[model samples]
Target: MEKLLVIGLDSVPPDLLFGKLLDSLPNTKRLYRDGTHGTLETCHPPITVPAWMVMMTGKNPGALGIYGFRHRRGSSYTDGYIVDSRHVSEPTVWEILGERGLKSCVIGLPPSYPPKAINGCLVTCMITPGPEKEFTFPQSLKNEVRRVVGEYAFDVTFRVEERDSLKRELFEMTKKRFKLASHLAREKDWNLFILHEIGFDRLHHAFWKFFDPDHPKYVVGNKYERIAEEYYGLFDELLGDLLEAAGADVPVLLLSDHGSKAMKGAFCINQWLEREGFLKLARPPLGVTEFEKAEVDWTRTMAWGWGGYYARIFLNIKGRERGGIVPPEDVPALKSELKRRILQLRDVSGRPMKNSVFEPDELYGVARGDKPDLMVYFDDLNWRSAGTVGHESLYLSENDTGPDDSVHSMNGIFLYHDPNNHQNQIKSMNAEEVAPTILNLFGLPIPDGMKGRAVKLS
Candidate 1:
């Protein structure tokens, strides 16, 4: 069987590889020329948590019961907790391979907290709580990582407002993650090796304005203007190193969970809900950050939203939630009405804003308990949706979390290279196809539950 080394970057755009940045990324250019590569269409509500899980498990977010980094635990929007790998209901490709005596190494995949038992070593992702906790699968592998790379860094702190500090931490985190992954690739005896890096995503989120002068918030000739491109160069160099460490005969798969683009502003979704009479509050809050402590008139509330890289809307349905209002029989008409109204919303400047609103049934084939009632992409993903209430207006100049410059796009990257068997240039592939393709490459039967099909690589 061929040894497979999978390198997962959090957010990378195809345009970066084929456009002006091409000149600086010679290795990536070579991969494009010599192997099969194309845009990878991400899952619905394409954020880091669900996309990675869908790719690794060959299951859609509906099947996995995970739509984002956090999900409603018991039908109430406020009654939710952060998601971890334990929430995944299906078996990962690593576990399937491990069951058959294959050894693998998994590092830094997001939402991989509370690390589970695998065939080999496993280091959890950014949500590991902190470096003080034991994050490795074997319980002793943390010591090995510390000995080899000083400390394991799951991810860097990303803040668009703090340009210098964000850049500094991004570089340091990238270096440490690569060092540990390279060490494992060279030292460990494994058939399947996987590693993930969030530096690219962080860089894009914090500094996209620097690269795209067309961005609404772009500052011309700023010191940080070239920073994003420079980081792409670093990513290419690191890719070359990891490829070398994987040796000449091994095939390498490179991809990201989703792409990213410049964000113009944030849309206050909860405020919109309030204006539209979908949500009700008992009193005016002292501040927007007081949402957790605010008293909501749930009986009068029909819907509410939560913000992140995207927005999720939940309906207070009768017999389902604590203060249920919408009846089960009225769900279809209500969802259709809300979707129509949301799409008709305009920007602050009174210009029509473009968006795509999806019901869980349309996107995922069924109504699920944990999934949101509606998933939205605003202004073609150039604007974020803020879930905070108490905003003076429906739109804000900055993200609620802070000042973020970028939001996730639907198209990511997928490149496959096999020294012995290579395919022609492919146009596109879905995140779901990855796991079954890997299983096919390893001569394992494609599991019945997987919806993805194996790609032809001859």
Candidate 2:
């Protein structure tokens, strides 16, 4: 039986992996030289949660009903919920393998917080509130994890101003994560294994401006200029160790959920909506205010938007929302008008921003769950959406929620190395193709409804 190993490096962009840093990463570079590698086009919204799930299930975000990490619960504006393992209704690749009695070892996969039972060991992702809660499947694996690495770190606080402390914690978290992964690989009995390292994403968010000279906020003599290289080198070394533990014969799939790049700025979507008369506020906030906390005159508002890497615009339809105003019949024209106006929005410099607006039904054949009426990407996602109001200007130089320096990109990386048969091809692959490819490698049937074709390794 052939074993498969998947190393999911969250938010690792191809430019860094396939470009200048490749030479420094000897192990990864060897994979690049001998394996089939390319850019993996991420799903719509390009968020971590839905993107990973989409790859594992071969389903689009709409099919999974997950728009982003947080979702507006039903039609309530104020009520919202964070996604968890429970929200995943579709069967994952491991689950499909488990049915055939093939065991798996999954670690740090997003939305696996309330860790569910699998055929083998399982450790939840960063979303786990803390380690105090049960974070491992079968419960006993928690003891083994604690025995391996004292006090596991699911995530780190990267948005803080303490650069030195943040850097130390970031490296330490990744060290523990990979250490545990290596231990599991050597000890666990499994046909399929997966390890998702979120440190790369954190590193990009916290240190991109320091390393990337192209960043607007970059300074030539910044102290953290070499941070990206150091982190990548560390990751490559750890990856080499894990490969050794997993054995040289096992085929490896190194991929990322999404890519990252320096953020230009944040566009205050709510403030813009208020200025455009699409949203009505009962009273102006005295200071920066969250959209849910603001006094919104929902009765008069035509549409409102939630913000993150992208904007999720929702309409106030009559008979749908509590204080609905716009009639269902007027939704199409209203959406078209909103789309047109949003696309025409200009930057702070009076230059037009490259904005894209997509209707849920049009983008995804089926709109499910609490989907937004329209999705907007400002400046092709270089600019993030800010949901907060009370800002004098509609644009903010920093993230509305935190001090994030990077934004998610559509192109992540994909490298598949089969020691038995090396293709050495560089071709682009879609996110959905990952699962079907995995099933194919395992000699399993590519289940119906999986919207992807397996990559030919021969």
Candidate 3:
């Protein structure tokens, strides 16, 4: 079997690749010309954590029991925990490959903290505590990584409010990621190699404001206007180096968990819930507050929400929550009403903001752990969902976390290159199809329970 190489670029957009930055990204352009490429539809609420897992495990978030980075462990909102790879119940493609005695090198995929043992090396990503912690499989590779590259960056420091410092930090981190990935590609012999870079995601989040002049926060003549474009150019150069190391005969798969778009603003969902009488706070907040710390009156609160790139609501139901109020019989009616009200929500200009609201039962069609009653998108991905309740009005000035410019979009990029085939092959794909497709490339059976079918590349 030809060796399979998977390069995961978290949150890479097609517009930038094929449209905006194509001329300068020569390697990527050549990949596009030489192989099959298309938009890979991502999992809903397409953030890093669950989307990449979907690509690896070939399962939906509901089946995996991982909705996002932070998931509710119990019925209470306070019971939420930062999701890690340990939380994943399904075996990843690498784990399955390992069972088949195939050597695999996996690096820097999200929620990969506390690296799991693999047939080959492992480098944890995103929530890796720090360089001081154990971030590699053999434990000794962490030191070697640091020795080769001064500091192995799991993620860029993304507090966009600190623009000047963030630019310098992001560049340094991008270079370090490329350096480490190049070293690892040549350091070991493996049947499959996987490496995910978070720099594209971080760059889009931080500098999307400067790149898109029409963004509400975009500044004219900003020094960082072309930062994202330039980074794409640098990434192309890195791709050339890495491909040189991987050699000519290997089949390459380039993928991103999700795409990114300009964020208009944040919609404070908790505040909206309070206004709608579904949620109640014990006292007026003095300053910026989080839902878990807001001291809510659960006895009176029938429903409340927590926020992220999207909004997630929990029904305060009897027999479920600590101070349950909404009875079992009343559940459906309440959900309907909640959905109706959410649809009625509007932006500051009074234009309808919400794109759609989802119920896990309707979407996933089965019971899942710690499922949210409703999932929401606003203004078709231009707005973020804010979880706080202290705001004087429905809207907040900016993201409470930081000055974020980009929001996640459901469409990500996928490019497949086969050394033997030159024609345009499969044109479009889903995030789940990737794992099954790779398994098929190795002449392995697609797991019967997987939600996707392998694409025919011959």
Candidate 4:
């Protein structure tokens, strides 16, 4: 009852549990045979930061005050603030446990930028920098996060190689991360031990063609499927290693924040903005021509942008506080107008959703006060929106007919094991049931904030 181990694998969709190539995944299937299981419902919009935070604080994003990435946009530059404990209004699971004289170990969970004060070990993830020296966790555990990410943890840039060595490096890192977590579990005698794997999320982003049969990126002429094969195969081995490492005396759980797909087609938010009078343009954008910059009006335009699983269109009311069109009195009308306009477009495939955007309320059933103003789900569920005002990839060039060709689904995979039997049984589950069950398992108080029910462990 004093020891619980949680392994977080990002972007693992629940449907991958069948007899297909992924279903044949030996260790995952073995895990099902050995454990009592169900889906862990991720946070609304199912993005990584929000979902994990929900698990940590046991509060909704609205209540927690981390509404999808950061503070609201300012017109020109829209870099989001990294989520931190200052923004968390309620006590987290770690804090609650610590109050009860129990210690916990937390590592590499996103938006841990400011680094919360936790018992035992505190290795922060998604932490930003002016100095790495500022947030190093006891030097020893900091070394572990580095062991998985190397120098790239601080500055993640693109690599030119295909799924060759880079993919192998990721798998090796996944192996080490879990191994390190297992080592920590043996080392710490506490109520909760958590390790979130960044591999699955990266795999979904970089190797979608292999798992997604519908991707335009996939080709019969290439080795894409091999990417999925090798990635999952290695993960299966790692899960087995984790199971063996834990030695079957404690509850071991596997879960993901969200699932993914490579989406094509970008709905130019600026395009929509200009059309709706929410945005103004400098000159000619992607498809426009014969425009003179001097003749175009800039004072009247707003900004529009997108990203995987999300989008935003807002007025340029940042500094013009005295006389801005989106004034305090107009905020209500503007939000409604933005929501109405986004729902009008469709993806290239003609699905009503590809071009639609849902506000936070629509996505999570949470109140408007706690959610982002707009949540857009692409057509085919594979189409994505751009987060930047003007992106080059939104429009198809003469040679490119496909949309962005990159996407991800917040829907993901979950696995749970019994402490008594090593490998006994398994099943499917919806994502919403995850939080309540874990709190129930830890014997922690479940807040009224959660909409999910605890899965029965007995």
Q: Best-fitting candidate, measured by lDDT?
A: 2
lDDT of 3 by residue, 158-264 (tens): 86577888777777787887788778888887889998999889888888889888788788898988897788888899888888777788778899999999888
- Residue 369 error for model 2, in Å? 0.8
- Evaluated against the true structure, the overall lDDT of model 4 is 0.59
On a 0 to 1 TM-score scale, where does candidate 4 land against the true structure?
0.81
Off by over 4 Å in 1: 367-369, 421-424
Candidate 4 residues 320-347, lDDT tens each?
Answer: 4222445556666776777666566655
TM-score ranking of the models: 2, 3, 1, 4
Clashes of each: 0, 0, 0, 41
Candidate 1 lDDT over 335-439, as tens digits, reads 888889989988889888888898777787754557888888887877798877777878988888876788888999888888776566876789899899889
The candidate 2 region of ten consecutive residues with least summed lDDT is 449-458
Candidate 1 or 2, higher lDDT? Answer: 2
Off by over 4 Å in 4: 17-23, 70-79, 84-86, 126-136, 143-165, 285-298, 316-323, 327-337, 349-351, 354-356, 361-372, 389-406, 421-433, 447-451
lDDT of each: 0.84, 0.92, 0.85, 0.59
Instruction: Judge candidate 1 against the unseen true structure and give its global Cα lDDT, from 0 to 1.
Output: 0.84
By summed lDDT, which 10 consecutive residues of candidate 1 come out lowest?
Answer: 285-294
lDDT comparison, 1 vs 3, better candidate = 3
